[model samples]
Target: MCEACSSATRGFLAAGDCEGLTSLVEEVEFTSHWSYEDDSNNDSTNASNDSVRNRSMVETRVPRYWSWHQQSGEGSFVPSPDLNGWMLTIDAQNLSVGYHYRLCLDVDGVGTMQGYGYTGVKAFVSPVKATDVDLPLPRARDAELQLSCPLGPSGASAFLATSCDTTLPATTRVTSLGEVRTASVPVLSAGSASACSVMLDTAHLPGGRHFTLCVGVAGSGASLGMIGLPALGDALVKVYVTPISAFTSPRGHGVVLLGQNEKLFITCSRCTGSSEVFISSGACFVGLASANSSFKSTPTFASLLLGSSSQWEAVLDTSAMPAGQAYRLCVDLDGHIDSTLGPGDSGQFVRISGVLAVSATGLAASRVTVPLQCSGCSTSTAAYLSSSCSVGPLDVISGPLRDAPVSMALDGMGGFTVTPGISGLELFRHYDLCVDLDGIGTVSESFFSGHSVFLSGLLQVLGFSTVFKAPAQPISLSCSGCIDTSKAYLGLSCGGAGGFAAALGATAKAAPTTVIRTSGTSELLSVDAALLDAGKHYVLCWQQYEQCGPGMV
Candidate 1:
């Protein structure tokens, strides 16, 4: 065998990192070499080579043998002749039984067992026990069976239980099998099995259920027996019966399951993630149409819940409402939910409930609008303003007239008329038609029951009279005399002694009086009463400047 080429030699030769030479074998006293030769004396070899032509070869009795092991001190010997480098046992042998971490093989000086050089080392991993085996049985029935004993390394017996099913418990037994001690299963009944599986009766499990097989081997001849898991596996058996009904909410839908005869209402204020619009009074329900089926229905109000993925649900009791007949289902995804219908849109009123069924064969459809009313007013007006014309005839003809007052007269003799009447003669008298002097002045008037007039330039509407065919001009009226009923003027007028005066119009002046003061701290001040008239409408305003605090009140 080659000195460094032999696997055994190389395995031991690489005691250190380098393979050229090393002294670790001498230090550790570990052998790292081996050799072999043809042994013709062996009965089996002699018989096989008996047909050799030469009688000397057939009768050869010379026994050739070679040996290789770590050599310390002494003289070095050359490799045996007629031998080629071959891997030989160095780290381990069948006779030797012990644990070793790192073992390398070197055959002569050429072969290597590991990456470096052959160490002639083969790994023998220890065996561990797997899960126990068990026979399947119905949850409600009594079960008993025999199991094989467990084993460990060195073929020793071990103690174990039949607790293969996670949902159940187990018991074990010990017995003696001739010279070797063995284990047997203890007697088990239905009561023991019931404790393992709660709520499971024999009636429920018509077929046997699956179970992991297990075994025990305590107090046996061997400490434990080795467990050899087979490649093939057996199919499991099961037995089942009718089951009870159950309820569960679908994931991520914000839903809940309810029992029979039960009712639920969901009020989600604003739509959340993935939701677009959120109206107040958003509500939803489920299974409202059918008693047995589950579902969510719409609320009666007009309020709607808006969102991209926003959703809600209502659970119902199975006992309360069953399947079949159509029920109420009203959904307002965008508008306010109201309780009733009225004359106009109230915004507050929305339909919360409506009929819903699988078939649309026979069903009535109706619609309703809610009533509207101002908060502080005594009488509410539901009338719709159809048409209004308030623009100077010149302005209407000259410009687009988009900014013209709707109720103001557009002609020089006309004023603003809010109500557009059917007749032309009636519209001219009631509304003073005139053109505005400039675009600065604003004239507002409303005729809910009369005709409208047009205007163009700067002018004023003096006043109207019940009997006169024409109104009085500013020069024809007397400011100092008693009030006259025969005529009314719509023009500019004087206020005091030398103030400017013009044609009298709808605007009225206050009666003049001298300035004076009252004696008491709290006195009633008379507002100009002349500014108000019997048949005309006006805006009256007053302000109170308090010099003191609550004490004054």
Candidate 2:
């Protein structure tokens, strides 16, 4: 008795490399593995005669194809009764077929009959072994990687791992091994897709390492993995057939999208009156005169018919599109009808751009452009367009805009202003007196002597507390350092002669401050004021410094 198969033949191999598998030998002979041609070299004439006679003799000994002969003693070599033409057969009565014969052709063989009987009889079936066909595993990839196992009729589960070997952490998905795994389970709705609990985190596996997958019966309690066909492969691309009349919608009333960019434009001439179209995925929508167009009721917006020719041009911004991917184009019409309407005519239809090929993934435009129109199938009861508005490119204002005054100053100190008048001058002098300054320009304490002075309380200024409330921080002055150095410095000064002086001195002591004196001109400035502490305020005054040259400065 011979055990035809053992566990050794079932051992797995790393994907892509099948090194030790056996090959099938079809013809069998128990003779010297040599030819008579060798002896011919020694004697030409003799060898030729010998060869012809030997060939004739060999042909006579060999029976016609499929002929049978007796074994050594009483046993016979009869063809198999179950099949014919090179059929492996046996003839016996009450003879128990003890062991199975191992036949190796392309791969290791295992099927061996046990029970044997007379001709035209059945034999005991042998234990069937899983045939290990040489199936090349897919090459591992950096992105999505899939390993498949053919489970024949039985469904299987396969573990997807980062490593070629199955030892590491992996994900398992059930698949029919040999053929398509047709599932009668509940349909996988929009959001419910079975996912493998095992995660293939590339970070865990060493880069460039190879992995092997196990193909085992699902729920078989085996460590090996099962297999299934890809969900996104050929089977998934089934042509979903639907009757054209199923979409009975009105013509010209719908939304249109162009290009992969999915830029949706208005179909109605009255842009403002046109319903705000929210284009999504590959759907288009228009108006329909049905009472229930929403999937639920008998009448639905599905009745709207957006015709083929009527399309709103969609100018997609390709810069915003992804590269090299397929996009679906769909349309839908959300019905928002006025109560005054009855069963109507102005029908809306979802419009889709003609079938187009997006060469590149990112933002793309269509070669053939289309004009757009909408449904005006005005019904007596339905509210039709009384008036409409058209829109164009928006108008925008430019140039410098005036802003509220932020900070004002007269000289190098913190100060307040005096309106242009005699009393204003007196009031200014009074404030100056309180500040203990001589006059607006002098910075002496005498001019502020008679003014009503108040400490104003200590307040949090920029970064420090001060007796007087800090005036608004100085506005910044825009200046290009590359321009006339003198003019840029002048541009930075926030009014006071001392302020300009300090700025010019700090910027370039050698570059004189003669040019930036815009005393009379009402100038706007943005100051950094890093020179002043946050909350601190100082005594102030204003003085006429350098006057602008005659007409302008």
User: Please, what are the lDDT tens digits per residue for candidate 2 over residues 359-471?
Assistant: 11110011111111111111110110001101111112111221111112232232232111111121101111111111222211111111111111111112222222223
- Model 1 spans > 4 angstroms off: 1-225, 228-356, 359-553
For all candidates in order, the CA lDDT equals 0.23, 0.22
**Candidate 2 ranges beyond 4 A from true positions:** 1-197, 208-215, 218-553
- Looking at candidate 2, the ten consecutive residues that score lowest on lDDT are 377-386
Ten-residue stretch with the least lDDT total in model 1: 544-553
Q: Best-fitting candidate, measured by lDDT?
A: 1
In order of appearance, the predictions have TM-scores of 0.13, 0.14
Q: Residue by residue across 1-553, what tens digits does model 1's lDDT show?
A: 3434432343322212323333323222233444344444555656566634223422323434221222111112234432553433333222111111123433333434434433443222112222222222222223322222112222221212212221111123333233122233331222422211211213222221122222221222211111111111111211111111111233111121123322323333322222111111212222233232323222223222244222333333332321111222222333233322111111211111111111111111111011221111111111112122232222331122222322222223221112212222211011221122222222211111111121111111223322122222121111211111212222122111111222121146333222122322112222344333445432211111211000000
